[model samples]
Target: MVLRIHFTAEDLLGTRFADGPAPLLELELAVAMRRRRDPDPAFARRHRSLAAPAARAIAPLNELVPATGAGPFFLDPLSAGLEDGLELVRRATRTAVRGELDRICRNGLPVTPLLRGLAHEDRQAWQQLERSLRAAHTALVDPVWPQLRAGFDTDLAWRGQVQREQGLRGMLAGLYPGSRWLGSTLEIAVAKQVEVRLEGGGVLLLPSAQWTGEPLCGPLPDGSLLLLYPALTPLPHLYLAERAPAPGADPDEPVAALLGRTRSAVLRLTLREPTTGQLARELGISPASASEHARALRRAGLVTTARAGRAVRHSCTPLGHRLIAAAGTPARQA
Candidate 1:
């Protein structure tokens, strides 16, 4: 049930679809570096140490791209509305990322509802946005593609060598259980590694290039990369789970062990206060079964039920809060 994977930077560069375009890769790398270099000394030191090589490799990219300081890419409406389209894509990406992270951290499982909704709601808008960005990149930024490609290829090769030497696969396997090692690719030639479920689930994609030498992990066969660079492999449906504690009362218990069928059902219904009937409808269980579980939770001090009008509503108690908080902590540390 556990999968692990390793990727090198070269794999990332290979995923580029454009034959010629401005070096969007460099811009993205700069943004990543800025994020990694936190103001806090300890955090900065860690990230910087991990990101150093990637940063050094892309040094030339910095020179070529230069910071605009105008905020994310903008399009002049009069020109072609490219900026507006890019902005829309940026917003969509942020929303998707945040939703996935929230689902992972809170539910201890991927929440398909959040992501599925985006696809349904914005399919047309996303398609149009993609077209606009592509047109802009091809028309306005094509001059820099050759230089960008060279820089990207060199960095990816170097990063791959480092990963191979350092037993990156073993390190990743230890860090991420149930991860599968997939090959690498390039998003604008900024080395990205991928891992996907061999059986079923979502893919994880990560960018290997960093300023401090820290490992980068992302969705396997990341959709963003596929959309921007279509010449590469077909993008797969990737479920990204943010690093989070497994759900349950005991950290020592395996997720499977702690979240047995009944416990999981109980936890889901009790996440927020609900009456027995509401719990039954949510869980597809009989009212009697729901009442039984509520009683069990009450006995465990995880829930407190009171009569409101004619129906009983179950709510979490202080003890329940403590249990939830404890469960939310990183399982490894706990």
Candidate 2:
């Protein structure tokens, strides 16, 4: 059970990371996570709580992106944004739609009226799908978009450094679990064994916030490979309640009393490894104030700060986490 990707020198030269997170691809993974997959219990519970509205909304997509197996190529259309991607899906030709539906059936998914209508390019069915996609994005993606964006920025910065210092092979080696970079071939362990020839088309690396599974690779509409991997940071923020806390709520009083209120909040914010500016924006403090607190925490070994591009990213160190735990702060769900 392995997926071997054969790459030529030209393919390596052409390999690149995506510009940012793909909303539609995230939606697909969100649907898949809900559908027959094992995920971290904390993540699963949080996802279910957040995705309740999207569960029904994603019905039209279930047949295409099943709990397992191949889905339609048009699903990840290499678009830069959600609306653009949806528009691309909306314009999928009847022949293309029918071909994909037939492929799904061949993979053992039953054909239903929705699939049938989509196969025939029914106008009402496409409309329903568009609405459903919009709903899913709003429910599952919109709430934590800022967090997603921050995570994306940090991942790209770190990956760029990896690419610069370790070259393409090193970047691929650390991408996902069960993957190895062996000379000209990238092998990934999976349930099914298959070989892919890049043929100089290269690969587009897409980091996903919601995809907790093993890496997935497939061809995009443009004949290039799309490799989706979990983002570098785990999204405990996703496990948080959607509602803002009631005014004057102090969940971190134990830690706050020890570290003072502002510093305590800063510590929790660093759990997601926000940039200095992002921390400032999140706490309504100046960047200098944020940096000062971060420096203090770093000096105390409570957090670690690293320069990523022009921004400095801060993350809670092991000691910081233990301190938060000892103080009995909720910190994050997991």
Candidate 3:
């Protein structure tokens, strides 16, 4: 069970990961996982109170996304946000929708009256789809979006660091559990055998909080190699909720209490291994304060400080990396 993707020089040069998770993709996969009865224990336990209500809310579209399909089906014309994604679906020409449905059905027949009449009465189908999508997102994702968004940003930042420090090859090598980078080729462990050769379309790596198992790779309508892989920092909803501060509490107060704001900022700023002076300047605090914080971090085994002649450097230790990762993602931008 191996899927091999051969990349060219141009493809290697252009391949890049997505900045953050797409709401529609997460919704699609989360719903698919539910349909197949693949329950994520942590997710289930945490969202249990709301699971039943959420399921009932989106029950209308259960038939459309059956537990079984002819093959993996991608949402047509991908979009990042909920409304934008639905807009793309709605804007898709009836012919495009029908062809996609045909492929998914694999029987050359419509799966439902809405699908059957999609060529003629698409507005109704689109409306139903949008309704279900909104309900599902509100019930399943909105409550936990802040944590989810932070998880995504943290993972993306780590990936960027890997790329900068170890090159693109290192980034790809760390991408998936059963995937490896061998020069220009990426060997994937998959149930279905697949062989793809990239032809200047590059690659889009999407980290999904809802995904589990091996990465799913395929060609998009635009002919790009899109790989949907599980996020490395997949913080469970239960875990996040437990750590979340009480309502009306300042979120930063907890960490700030644990480590004074100056020291905490110094440690986080050193995630990039800056000089004590550089860190001090960045935090707008005195260089002595930064040095003191670095020493404290070193004592706590959260960071390592080393000297290169007259120049001293500060970098995060494994424990420090873990701490930052556990802190959750940064604010997201559109």
Candidate 4:
């Protein structure tokens, strides 16, 4: 049977976590400890501390914490099967950071930054504390490191070749089973795009591109893509979804009307809780244009606006979501 591969850029991005080599290297020592059944109390304490902040950062993305399962795992909210995996990541990052710090310090490297810019005496004290932390991490992962490293190296070599040859599309096809390419071109066309920096020092790339595809491209169920980049932690995942079209939309709608339609589409994609900036960037329109379109949607009773801090946030009314969902195919013209 010919295997029909559903691929998306988002899927390829997600694979960077489970299938990428970097994570394997980070997790090696931790896995080793597990294999040896060594219980390291200090490592456990630091892990718990790290998880608190990590969980707080991830909370807005969803109601529940992500689950951890066996190795080579992918998180599909639609499946509702994978364990909440964020905690595992929290521990892993902490372990890696501690290890790197210790490695530097043991070689008599400057430990000032790791000590929060303290003076020499304070730095020495911090170094002692760091050593304790490193010991804990080593105890946690030492046993499984070797096996995890071997597997990680193999996958990385394979994926690196795929990325180099296929670019984004071919790599995604190999990684995900059911992703659809929405845009006609390999490079997604969008208006203005912005990279938003998160509190965790991570970046979110927001682009407004016209999507084209079938099956996965059409109206999908309530779930979005969580893309990961192997190089970055904290804000690794990119959330993506297709915008539903507007109903009773004219084939020859004015640019203003088209802008309105696009605004509605963005709000739907955001579940009616996107910022003006996010809307503008995603629709390839100016902030002024985005504001005007939002105002129009509000006037039409399609969207409601409220204050999220100093910024205004938009959400669709039930009537609006239904209207957009009923609009069927988007107009061919921009």
RMSD of each: 21.2, 11.6, 12.2, 19.0
Q: By lDDT, who's the top model here? A: 2
In model 3, which runs have C-alpha deviations exceeding 4 angstroms? 51-53, 66-77, 107-110, 119-122, 235-334
In candidate 1, position 10 carries an lDDT of 41
- Backbone clashes under 3 angstroms, per model: 42, 0, 1, 27
Evaluation by lDDT, superior candidate among 2 and 3 = 2
Clashing residue pairs, backbone N/CA/C < 3 A, model 3: 150-329
Regions of model 2 farther than 4 Å from truth: 50-54, 237-334
lDDT, candidate 1, equals 0.38
lDDT of 3 by residue, 1-334 (tens): 8878899988888798776677766766666556555545545555456667677877755545544322224342356677787777667665666666776566333377756655465577667767887898887667767656765665576567667866887678667644677777889777667788899998998876665545776677777888877665443631343464323334464333334445556657777788988987786757765676676566445678889788799987765665555556331211
Off by over 4 Å in 1: 1-3, 6-26, 38-148, 155-196, 199-212, 220-334
lDDT of 2 by residue, 1-334 (tens): 8889999998888888888877777777767776766654546766667644567776777766777525676665757788899888877777877887788788788988878777777779778878888887887777767666655665676566556756779778757654787888999877878899987789998876566566788877677898887665434332242233312337446555444456667788888999999988888868876787686566445689999999899999865786677667655732
User: How are the candidates ranked when ordered by TM-score, highest leading?
Assistant: 2, 3, 1, 4
Q: What TM-score against the true fold does each predicted structure earn? A: 0.24, 0.68, 0.65, 0.23
